[model samples]
Target: MINFVKIILIFSLMASPCNSLELYGKFAQGGLITGKVDKKIDLYVDNKKIKISDKGYFVFGIPRDQTNEIVIVTKKNKKEIKKLIKKIQIRKFKIQRIDGLPKRKVSPTAEDMKKIRSEGKLISKAKNINSNLNYFFDSFIRPAKGITTGVYGSQRILNGKPRRPHYGIDIAAPKGTSVLSSNSGRVILSERNLFFTGGTVIIDHGHGLISIYSHLEKTFVKKNQLVKKGEIIATVGSTGRSTGPHLDFRLYCNNVPVDPDLVISLN
Candidate 1:
């Protein structure tokens, strides 16, 4: 009778529905996580389906300001396996306030309204271009040599009114300084004389990663051009509501703006 009971227990253990599921990564904000499971699993962050890939391997990234506990669930054979990710530390960032920006710089006059509308249309068109960007995991290089004038996440106080936080890092450089591609990507937008950004160029770095270079003295790359890392794409300039010659570099993941400094090593 004891032997019979042991045999039954071993069979039940072997027939259990738990798969080889593992969720491993740094549990910090703005960090990337790698997940593996035996079967294709539906991934969710705060109850939003982000993505699912074949072979049960998927990647998810935490935003810089996210603080909620992440929950991952996989269901097989009507049984659910749940995993809770905790103790995530959201990094604290510095906030800067600028008090001297002129009113005209923040608000355009009636004469410039038409240009603003035109620029908006161009930005809308560029945002619609879809690029299967997931191959941009290479190291990033500085696009130009200059002093770091502005930083990411700084709150803007335009004429005593709080504005949206600045999402890009600004480098102060001389006019006509050559701007290079930070990583390999396909140019998605190249437009000159925008209302606010001036000569702007946007590159899609596969898998929803994009880089925007603004206030260019001249644009060298065209739309749909594939550029390599460190290749010259534009020249820095002071155009379109800028105080002086500088480059405003912005990075985005899908539609969410992210800090460029978080992914790249400036040193």
Candidate 2:
């Protein structure tokens, strides 16, 4: 009966349910992963339904502190077709201490709290826009020329007080240095000054993928404007709660913050 068992194994392998599933990109925390499946199937990550493009392309993000294995499920109609388990690579973050930030900026006043809340709503609304543009499939470019001063997933201790982790890359450059668009996208939010991230601009790269430029000296693009890859969208500067002239660039997929440096390195 050994031959009979071998024949059954071959038939099972041939009929595997997830043969059409394909994935790409880093499978670690703060990483962006692109996936593909049969156009007729639905993809879900951790039970959240992911948006699949017309061409079967989809994307997801791993949060910085996601340490557990992610469960990816595919379904056709109401039937569960297959499941894939993705183990996340844990990251060790550095503790970054900023000594000289203004006390008010670090710990805002009651009036400042209102401004922070209002500005935060705008930023959140912009980043959560889901579009079908599909420009995220293109390779990304560096948004500025500068020395890398900070990195993603680093703990921030601002003015002697511990704060949240830094979710963006800080590129040190001279004030007024042009900041380019990392990918072709539509500008969703362009604010001249916010409470924290002054002169911020957010671009939607389609499929829940977005790019954010903060601490800008100037903004060249407006809300709803279409920008091309490497196009000048802003200039570097020390604004808001910044310590020096630098560009704080960030990327996100499905509203989950990701590493901008990792996204560019994917090219």
Candidate 3:
């Protein structure tokens, strides 16, 4: 009887829930995860350091092209705890091809490249600003009404040459069409012209989430302005290297670009 009791006690001790972590998310593509963790524990995903919030919570996002198993390790006081490895889900996306001519057009020259590089520096600065607010989850609306010409994660063969996969969804609308805010966010950038993007706008939705609107005819909102969902922020145009009047909408979570279609439903 004494030996049986000791064996039961040992089994119970081994089954304790402490030193364990639970992770889950709606979508696993692009190496993204949202979960909770111990405050004092050091966390590693596939041996990479991840950022953790002060409340002992953490969210790590991976890019679309990365495909590998994730390993999470937590440590404290030289003691280590590891969770069972989780395999990342591979996403299969569709391809789209667009052939069109533009009414108004401009080509990038050597001088234009210099100007674009300078403007890129400003856009990069705005996207890195961190705010302690949760304004992104408030309702999302379409920025403009038009036909979706291009989709996210689509491989592009532009003018008979292959290019990088399209990261933004293209909305083909008439020139001067009003572009509204998809959700409440602070305007991080409003540039009039870029070499590839033409006029561009970026909004920070807090918690490392950001939205970018590119190829605009006109910009109505200024930098650092707080905008509400459905607010008119810009006008559609065929600026930059585009072939027609349209809006290119892109979304990112913690520097990892995500499919906007996953976050919001389109009408």
Candidate 4:
């Protein structure tokens, strides 16, 4: 008989010849799910191969608006085996409206568009990193101390024009406020200035999981640098399409944006 495991918060699936597989974390929209399996077993989420570390740990993210049940399949000896179906809870998002001054930031000219496109490539490259480090298993801390002004999955209306849903949490703080690393990871990309994010820093926490810090006033870390959790990596600032000083904190699992709040709860 095949076993299918349904998860709510925490559970352990026993599929023998392999011992026990433990899973935990939020299982809702914009949630990040992580688990551990035996080294000999192969696992997948939604048919996409999950990169398991040598110690048998793996991670994946739930889409912000995903309503369909997640499918988890495991195979061994090049043959089909057990499966686990995870159902994610739905969430209601908030609407945010902002009235700003500069028309160019909202609607850029052809010249600015060229720069935006190029900077986008850099950001995308950093977000897609899949390293083998297992730093993601560490406890996470808030990137900075501030009041949350914007939340994940929120609809943003800028100057009465609708834009893409906000994927990061906007924390409002005074300029030069210190921003710390949420967890131990290697810096993958550190750009002083980008078209939208201004000064940005992206850290890879291993196994396709990464965290992004944007709108920085100054960066203390450089590319390929290893940072410890709660270490000061940068200072907050209002740069690149901003009205005031703030930090836009974000996290991505396999390039899919997940809620930073949900991830921090893993601590």
TM-score for candidate 2 = 0.92
Q: Considering lDDT, where higher is better, how would the candidates rank from best to worst?
A: 4, 2, 3, 1
Q: Per-residue CA lDDT of candidate 3, range 122-216, in tens?
A: 86776666565455434356689999888778887665555688887899999999998888899988988877788999998776777899999
Clashing pairs in 2: none
Best of the two (1, 4) by lDDT: 4
Q: Which number leads on lDDT?
A: 4
lDDT tens digits by residue: candidate 4, 1-267: 111233433334453536456676777889888888787778878898888899988889998999999988777675656677878778899999989837898999999999999988888888788889998867678999999999999999999999999999999999999999999999999988887889999999998889999999999999999999999999999988899999999999989999988877666
RMSD of each: 10.2, 7.3, 9.4, 4.3
The number of the candidate with the highest TM-score is 4
lDDT of each: 0.69, 0.85, 0.70, 0.86
In candidate 3, where is summed lDDT lowest over 10 consecutive residues?
1-10
Q: Mind giving the per-residue lDDT tens digits that candidate 2 earns over 1-267?
A: 011110101111116554477776777788888766777888789999999898878888999999999998878886887777877777788899988888989999999999999998998887788899888877788899999999999999999899999999999999999999999999999988988999999999999899999999999999999999999999998999998999999998878999876677766
Pairs with backbone N, CA or C atoms under 3 Å apart (clashes), candidate 4: none
Model 1 Cα lDDT, one tens digit per residue, 1-267: 011110101111123444555554455555444455554444455666544344555445566677888765555464555544456666666666666555666877887887788778877666544455544545567788999888776777766777787878999999989999988989989988787888999988765667899999999999999999899999999877677899999877555666666556422
In model 2, the worst 10-residue window by lDDT is: 1-10
TM-scores of all models? 0.75, 0.92, 0.75, 0.93
